[model samples]
Target: MSDASPAPVTAAILVIGDEILSGRTKDKNIGYIAEYLTNSGIDLREVRVVPDVAEEIVAAVNALRTRYTYLFTTGGIGPTHDDITADCVAQAVGVGIDVDPRARAMLLERIKPEDLNEARLRMARIPFGAELIENPISKAPGFMIENVIVMAGVPSIMQAMMDSVAPRLKTGARVTAETIEAGNLPEGGYAEGLAVIAKAHPGVSIGSYPSMTPAGFRNQIVVRGREPEALAAARTEIEALLARLQAERT
Candidate 1:
């Protein structure tokens, strides 16, 4: 038979804001975007949080856009001097930046022509040869310059923009995940065996996560892969290992 399909498409997230680094504003967008991309068959591989500096933004955009299938940038696309992400994106792509008529029309939906001040009009600036990602919640649309998509910092607006662009993006096989719940088990006991299983099944990824909850400490071994059979095999190996260890303790 033909070989199984390749891994899911890859992506990276670039978070830009001074408030985030300063701890003044706790970030709520990264987790949301990570989960969203996971469900959309896009593997979010790298995440970077940079200050609202034009040079930093440009550098990150250049780096991530080249390294991944898609690059998602959140924050710095607002209506203030710190909102310099749009210009940075333009500069990164080596393209002239200007207020696009389409983007201006989107903003006009919320702001009247007379009230469209310069600060608000700044939202309409987009890089040359970029596509607008619609924001249903807010009239200020996000933009996609080639593979690098620039989005708002607000969680609601970023989610809306993602919904709009997801349909148009090229998606790959959805990565499936399996979790084996271990009750208060020490990760040290199974770390070596899990490593062996991981090496045996090169196609799958196995990770052990330990968390503390109100009830007590809990551990979970999560296996992720594209193939169901391979995933099941790895999970079986993990379960058997756990059973043997439990029996030995008893």
Candidate 2:
């Protein structure tokens, strides 16, 4: 292993909505955030799904923002009556929410002055000193306050915001992953040997995924490492172990 320090980046995703908790709507932000963070070389350490309760939202936002290097929140910031993410986040960060001049100008560019009613005006309310995150699909913008970045709940808007914001975030050395598929092997049968192999390589992470096949069952073992040399060495050992185990079974 290299003596270099590990990347200094961590992130967390907060999915907020009563609909998701009630199973009326499936949450999609977690997967998107996880993949995006991984690709950006930020370790996604935690994910939380909370109902649209003011106290819960405030608590979660406070806790996550303080703990992680970056906190991304989705949902509960719309124009509807239930939308309280902005207010909660404002309270969490000890900032006052007001109609931001930049946000109002951005919204006014797309929507007519007559259409800008109280409900629509709510969209312009953001925490003090927050920077706007561009939304290409819709005129409504997301905001970044301190370490926390808030975005839309809709998948398309979230993705667009991520595309715009990714280049600005700090990145670290990316972790590399490799996989080996062992056809028709039972996980229970190979668990002992796999454990031995795992023990031998402390720096590599190995996981076994079992699946059903037309012939019988299959097992896939994935090995991941940050260093190429360590990763290749670990894969060689894992392949040899798998070959020996297969030979024994046959």
| Cα lDDT over the full model 1 | 0.91
Per TM-score, the best of the predicted structures is 1
What TM-score does each of the candidates earn? 0.96, 0.94
lDDT of 1 by residue, 83-121 (tens): 999999999999998889999999999888999999998
Among residues 3 or more apart in sequence or in different chains, the pairs in candidate 2 whose N, CA or C atoms overlap within 3 Å are none
- Give the C-alpha miss distance for residue 113 in model 1, angstroms: 1.1
User: Which candidate achieves the best lDDT against the true structure?
Assistant: 1
* lDDT tens digits, residue span 1-250, model 2: 7987775599999999999999998888889889888877798999999999999999999999999899999998788889999999999999899998888888888889999998988888999988899887777889988888899999989999998788778888777888898777778777888798788887788899988768777789999767788889878987887788789978
